[model samples]
Target: MVPTMVLVADDSQDTDRKEALRDLADAVAERGEAPVVRAFGSGSEVRRAVHSVEGPMVVVPAFVAGGDFASAQLFAGLDLEGRFDACPTAPLGAVPSMVADLAGRLSASGWTDGDGVVLAADGSTGQDERQAVTDVARMLSRRLGSPVQVGYLNSWAPSVGDAVERLQRNGRERVAVAAWRLVEDRDYDRLHEMGAASVTAPLWPSEIVVDSLLAQHRAAKARLAA
Candidate 1:
């Protein structure tokens, strides 16, 4: 087996963010498969770490969806000028398992068909990124047998507050906001101000998430071997 390094590139300077990624790294190691390193801070920092590795590597963004920072932009800043051994899978949110996690979170919170849901994600400037969040919302909609709206914490239209108001206008008084983030940030805090009856936690520290990360790593390794 090739010595693979699991890289987590995150932009947040918060201590909790670093700790959470470290916890995730611990979880990855617990799988008894590959060695893990928890590098946090910036894309460049992660890039420098990746550049030191001499074998197959999988850089999995610790993000739920592909926001501008988590997608190509993050990797673009890396010093991988000629490195082809490192591979990146899609953002964790795009995987189908996350939809199940979101559904389960909402259902566990007493959400019903009569209730409304707003898929809350951090703001991103790219329309493609916004669509990714929307796609996750639609998947949740299908799972719960109801409609789910998309909302952002920073960039784009249809803020969580706006979604909540719209749902209330549509006669759905009970509204919940499903967190489409990996860790809590200022954006996660804004969920309460949106007037949601309930807000779910970010997708992390779950068996489903660990499974998703492992799956992405395997796929990327396969791609590299091919």
Candidate 2:
């Protein structure tokens, strides 16, 4: 077994962006996942600078469907670089606690019975990823006690706008959008423009992600040690 590595950030991505993830990764290496790291400030921003890295070793994926592609690309890059022992944390979607996190955001957004739901995802090319999104939607639906519709921001049919509009056309007003990505991004801004009554925030800056990252990292690392 290889040594397990926690993914707080995808160093494989742009040089910037994930100072917190990388910092948490480093903290996980030395201390633990959540020990008042020097990096985390206000639980919202990173106080320190993120040093540059050569390549991606582990990706703390934002969401499963989109993380799949980024992780694959990073894995391939590792192969090309001759670093084969790299490991990454499972996608946030794989973390059961995330379901609660999703539900929390929905509730905060005032989602209730008779209001339409659109589980908006970043979209992916893999069928498995699509299934993963659907599975999450199903979970959310059960939690909400109502039907949930899936809408892709890119890649597949039934766009977010279309889904929202479809619900509106059906006379179900007050549509809420649950963005399943890791962090809030520009892509989600348009949801409000589309007249979503509420758009749930991403998964980061929450205890669920922090706790999930720690658990998944320990499990993977334990496997390697075994």
Candidate 3:
């Protein structure tokens, strides 16, 4: 069994995700218990990262929607024996406190009392993944004392435009979109064009997001001890 610990952040090939992964890796590298950082985008990158890591890995699913893609494409094929499998850590989203964090993002984006909110996410193909997004919307709705809409940026229905237009039709003077991504992507600017008055910042570099990732890493370490 290998003795070293490695941290992997899984996500798409988007530029912001790559940058955020590198930044997270650099931060992780400075700590005393720091594991090696290996990040992957496509299958080729995943294979390369796997071949280079000669140790147990804890995959931190950076995707807010879910980790199925990362689990299947990136760290699923690791051949660790007498050590932790390339077990993926918990998802970044779907936690109880995340609604508050997302609310904070909306407020930070200048969301007002009557402004409609659409919790925008990178759409997921899996039922559980989409349900996770819906769960977040419900919590945010309760927190803000207003109904929150769930919208997908890709791979699902109720697109951002649809949600925003529905709010407008409902007579909401303004609507804000709360982003559920690790970092702002190309779609962010277009969100404004979709009839949103404002858009929240991505989850990257936030204490909530970083803490979630590290918490997963620590949990993985605990599992190894067990």
Which prediction has the highest TM-score against the true structure?
1
Itemize residue pairs with steric clashes in candidate 1: 64-93
**Which has the greatest lDDT?**
1
Model 1 ranges with Cα > 4 A deviation: 66-73, 126-128
Ranking by TM-score: 1, 3, 2
Error of 3 at 127 (Å): 2.2
lDDT of 2 by residue, 1-226 (tens): 2233323323333433355345444544554432222222221222121111223233344345543344323322322134344344445563567877888899898998899999888666566677788888889888889888888776577888899999999998789998877654455555677678999877666766667766665665555445
Per-residue lDDT of candidate 3, residues 1-226 (tens digit): 4223354444564676667667766665555454655655676666566556655666665556532344333444544455445555545656766668878888888998999988887665566677777887888888899989887766577888899999999999899998876655565556777878999877666666666666777777667657
lDDT tens string, model 1, 7-92? Answer: 56564556666676677778878997777765556766776666667776777766766432442356545555566777766666
Q: Predict model 2's lDDT versus the native.
A: 0.60
- The 10 consecutive residues of candidate 1 with the worst lDDT sum are 66-75
lDDT of candidates 1 onward, in order = 0.73, 0.60, 0.67
> Considering TM-score, which of the candidate structures 1 and 2 is the better prediction for this target?
1
**How many steric overlaps are in each model, in order?**
1, 2, 0
Q: RMSD in angstroms, candidate 2?
A: 6.4
For model 3, what is the C-alpha lDDT against the true structure? 0.67
Candidate 2 residue spans exceeding 4 A from truth: 1-59, 67-84
TM-score of predicted structure 1:
0.89
After superposition, the stretches of candidate 3 with alpha carbons farther than 4 Å from their true spots are 1-13, 31-33, 66-84
